[model samples]
Target: MSQETEPEPSPGPKQENGPTTTGSFLCLHTSPPLHIALHGMSALTHTRLSRTAFDLCLELLEAGVKPQALADIVVHILEFKEQFN
Candidate 1:
């Protein structure tokens, strides 16, 4: 059964030195829902994939999700996908 999660706090401005609040996100440890979304996004054409990734990140930022971590995950996934071609 799926358990409900607590809502994440909205992202704040970056802190100087030490970890920022969002730093705790750690993309590799992302939840299953996000992993599914990223996997679906990876199926698009090259240009579309890039644009879709960017748009998803922008939406995540607006939703107060971990944009930087999502961006990193997108980049890493894209890089891994590209290497096999």
Candidate 2:
């Protein structure tokens, strides 16, 4: 069954690190979500994927849903986001 999620604490959409087309920024804030997601990506790829993946990872982390495995689910979610949209 589908469930509605609680709202996120992050800032609104207008505060993007870059333009929507560019999709992300170069500055590293050292947030937990970014720390994990940026683990293996190259500089170029990280800047590109960070926009979408960072938000998703932040949402998951805020929900108190820690995974016992490694970065597996994070990778899967990234792939899904890329594949579907």
Top candidate on lDDT is 1
- Candidate 1 lDDT over residue span 21-76, tens digit each: 34434242234466566556655544346545655664566457775687678779
Q: Which ten residues in a row have the lowest lDDT in candidate 2?
A: 18-27
For candidate 1, what is the TM-score?
Answer: 0.36
TM-score of each: 0.36, 0.29
Which regions of candidate 1 deviate over 4 angstroms?
1-49
Give the alpha carbon lDDT tens digit for every residue of 1-85 in model 2.
9999998898757765531221233233445455545654534465344656655654454445464442577677668888988
Steric clash pairs (candidate 1): none
lDDT of each: 0.59, 0.53
By TM-score, who's the top model here? 1
